[model samples]
Target: MISKIYSSSSIYFSTDDKIDFFGPKCTREPSYNYKLSGKQDGDGGFWNTFYELDFYIIHNCTNHGAKMRQIRRNTQYAPASALFVEIKPWNSSITNQGQETAEFF
Candidate 1:
């Protein structure tokens, strides 16, 4: 995914502007964490703490695997861009059922 972003454009983050919260800095190469593209705390932060619930997310866990993703649309900058994601779990087992699972979070 990161490769695709860099291959498509020249908007990669610079060494001086690289985000190092995840690891060593000095991004001589383009990297992606998408989180690094935005603030992670306070106002305007990614997943803005002010309106956490405003960003809707869905997590589905099943016998195959688990998926967690968020969708944001109709924002100030972009007219219509949707961000979706999925995950393949290595190991997982059902811990709750139906309504009980929803209430836990």
Candidate 2:
């Protein structure tokens, strides 16, 4: 299996664990809609902008999936740059559909 990784500060919310992608104070809000990419130990650093469809929250995991919805020409932030990504819990049901269907048969 391929291992994918991501870099992000641990998310802290005042309410339930359910984080809202568009809510106030969210790190992924419009003004802060930027994310970082690349391997953590190597020379991996890049930035990408966010859009309406690039929003999601993952549970029980930190890694997220992203698409380059918008590209920016500026790199003023440099190494401190970040990239917002959409994350969701791995759906076991979706992953095990084949076995589940066989059991039903």
Candidate 3:
């Protein structure tokens, strides 16, 4: 299936437990517009600029199987940066077959 892309629009994210990609916000989600501001409270973090590069934050709306949408934003957005990615070392002795570290569990 071909999903339409909003290349001219911006993106945002909600870290609040009460918010999501779809739900009450989804209805509020625009069909042809975007919100990209951190000016007002509860506007979600408008970190990334709209349509900057090919960068996008997408999520599958709740109860919408096999469908996904990108997080949208308004005009006043916050500039953000990816600080670092956390990497965890793989423990072969604990996870490998027959290594058997059941006592830790």
Candidate 4:
């Protein structure tokens, strides 16, 4: 799993000047191969962190093969400082579980 830690000082802004962490355009490319996991961490604790998984498209172009999981931490105390993601599938066989798995930081 790929893990990243963000401090509480980073300034994130949207194209519309709106303040956001994940912003409104955070999503996987459709033409590319990938699948996103669920939102795992939301507890207001020192160990809070966000996690997700991406499954790369295989040679067949119809199935997902290689996969990678990413984890990140909140950089600010904003109420909207939560994890957000979108999953894109190459085909319709892939399904969304809509479940998050949390772990200590």
Ranking according to TM-score, highest score first = 3, 4, 1, 2
Q: Give Cα distance to truth, residue 18, candidate 1, Å.
A: 26
Which candidate leads in lDDT?
4
What C-alpha lDDT values do all the predictions have?
Answer: 0.23, 0.24, 0.26, 0.29
Clashing pairs in 3: 10-50, 34-73, 35-73, 35-74, 36-73, 36-74, 36-75, 36-76, 37-76
Q: Which lDDT tens digits does candidate 4 get at residues 24-56?
A: 222244433323333333333454342223232
**What TM-score would every model get versus the actual structure?**
0.16, 0.15, 0.20, 0.18
Between 2 and 3, whose lDDT is larger? 3
Model 1 Cα lDDT, one tens digit per residue, 27-98: 333322323222222222343222111221222423344333222221222111224322121222222212
Q: Please provide, for model 2 over 1-105, each residue's C-alpha lDDT reduced to its tens digit, 9 standing for 90 to 100.
A: 111222332224422221222222223222233332332222232433222122232221123432112211211222423343334323231111111111100
Q: Which ten residues in a row have the lowest lDDT in candidate 4?
A: 14-23
Worst ten in a row by lDDT for model 1: 1-10
Q: What is the lDDT of residue 70 in candidate 1?
A: 24
Compare candidates 1 and 4 on TM-score and give the better one.
4
Error of 2 at 11 (Å): 3.0
